[model samples]
Target: MKEFDFIRTLKKLSPLPWERTVGNDSAFFKLKHKRGLISKDILLEDQHFFSSIPADALAYKSLAVNISDIVSDGGTPRAFLIGLGASSNHFSILSALFESLYKYARQWNIPIIGGDTVYSDKLLLSITCLGDAPQNPWFRKNARLGDYLYITGTLGSSAWGLSKIPTLGHELSDPHIKRHLYPPLYLDFPSLFKNKIHAAIDISDGFYQDLTHLLEESNLSAVITPETLPLDPSLPPEAKNTALRGGEDYELLFASPLAPSSRRWPPNLQKIPIAPIGKIIN
Candidate 1:
């Protein structure tokens, strides 16, 4: 398909009320608040993914990382714009990508407004996501001493899955491999306590390294009980260390005051399994 055809296809898929398709040079969005959050993440062919990965999975990830940022800030994702660069003549790949992106957009209730596409040597995707920043969104600098550091879901699974991707083809459907290819849309957890969390970040760059970012942003330190890490039980022993250093888990690492014993978080999140693994200090 040509560039215009691709744009038309996207317009057909986007049914959100705020999406305005014509008479304007840019897509229109409705922002309920004065403050907004905008974030971008780029995926390069060789550096970010191998050539063998499915186009659909790559498309899903292109938007997922950006969604991770919006919710991490305790904001609700409203819309996005995608920039695509590709040299391949296979228009079917482009179709698959658009379909995959639309699928995720509907699941998250976010819309793809507008973007530019170009021909390049390899597949390249740049996504810019916009959202309404909460009145009291979580910030890295808000971490305070004595607040418990908690993480939702397991770590190291993405790293483990990435390691196996080379040997296994796109058709391979292992759970760990699926985790790496399709990170969960965990925005629900952040939305539950929107203005209440102390500090928050998605564990995209491994748990420990991202924790360092939180500490640096807050100018505070933390003491983690290594034994308390919520590691993936399925990871092999040799890959255990990846739990701390492997990136791309995309789980939320957040800080909150200790809750009362009677307090129960949204039980719907039970499937993701939240855990308190450490405390901010110094």
Candidate 2:
């Protein structure tokens, strides 16, 4: 069965209070004084990534994807737990991975709280991120009809980078390759657009597919203008399809009531070029 089909089956079995969190990027629940948000992501060698990938790159991407989920929901990540399944107990690889992971952890000011490790036939990484939820956290179901759809940064760079990896050998010097390996994290986005964003999802599974998730959850549709897509100018004309369907971009695709030209955004955020690509429709 397909991934969504399996998810649908799981959702049916989910408990009443948790059902709403099943399909969202992060699970939100009440805390003593403030709400809490949590998300988990798993990466497997030869599946989510290649075994040839460097330990540092693999570690960074694993943490980044999970953090993206928390940020998309308008949460500030507080701490994370990691579960590692190693095929072999190689100290060098493990050390490098943790070194990179901790470096990013310090940079984000989030701590590595705890987790477990196990022996396996292949390398596997599972990250569970916990964060402080915003007053009105963004959700896929919160998108309203007529809300404008906007996307951050560019698309297709990660996919383009992946394609070149076989030839370029994971060189971080190439922008595309670097994007595929170390996706740019938008940690400050939620704080910047806190009040304006209605719904949001990180573009890890391609723009079209992830947008479909947002629309489905909102019980709405959308009308997208192809020309409005913020495709990277460096990409070739033929890369449009890749930009639409290529996964692992890790950029934010969100809905907002404010028009693309709305001056309601903060001055600093105004400088970031968020493209209005589509609008939620009936």
Candidate 3:
């Protein structure tokens, strides 16, 4: 079975209460005085990334992706726990990873609360992120028939960067290479839009696949205008296909009745382009 099919089977076996929240970007629950959101992600060497990737970049991407999950769910990240598995000989790498991890944690003001570490033959990293959720968190199921589909930032840069890794290891000065190493975080997006968004998902598994998740959950279809797709301008014309199907952009894909206009966005958010590429349909 495919990854999503396996996930569907697991969701079927899950308890009734959790089934409702099981498939979202983040799991939501009530906290003492506020709603809480949580998500976890794992990365393995040679699979998700190459061994030659800089420790700092690896650490940042690992933690940032989990934080993306929280933000996609309309939450502000608060803290995280990390699990690391590496052979003892890689202590230097571990040290650099932790240093960079803590640096970003301080930069983002999110704390590293707790987690476990184990020795393994291969390098592995896992992070569980916690956040304060909005009263009504965004979900894949909340899309409406007339909502416009919008995406933040450009697409395909990361994929393009990945293709260059074999030829240019650790040469992150290249913008595309840097994008692959460190994805831009949309930490303030949730708070900025708040209740304006109807549905949301982060583009981790390519535009087509991730958008399909929202459509399936919302029981709707979309009509995309080919011209409106926000392909990375830096990529060549042939890379248009990569923008549509390549994964790991980590940008926000959301639905709303109102089309997003740069004129209305704050200066900071304006720097991150938003484009309406499609709309929901029956």
Q: Cα RMSD (Å) per model?
A: 2.6, 9.8, 10.0
Comparing 2 and 3 by lDDT, which wins? 3
Superposed by TM-score, candidate 2 places the C-alpha of residue 205 at a distance from the truth, in angstroms, of: 1.1
- Candidate 1 scores a C-alpha RMSD against the true structure in Å of 2.6
Lowest lDDT block of 10, candidate 2? 10-19
Off by over 4 Å in 2: 1-32
Give the number of the best model, judged by lDDT.
Answer: 3
User: Which candidate has the highest TM-score of all?
Assistant: 1
User: What lDDT would each prediction earn against the true structure?
Assistant: 0.80, 0.80, 0.81
Candidate 2 lDDT over 7-81, as tens digits, reads 234324422322233355444443434688989988887888877788889988989988999999988888777
lDDT by residue (154-243, candidate 3, tens digit) is 999998888888998868898988998899898888878878888999999999999999999999999999888888889977776667
Better of 1 and 2 by TM-score: 1
Compared with the true structure, the alpha-carbon lDDT of candidate 3 equals: 0.81
In model 3, residue pairs whose N, Cα or C atoms come closer than 3 Å (at least 3 residues apart or on different chains), thus clashing, are none
Model 2, TM vs. native? 0.85
Clashes of each: 0, 0, 0
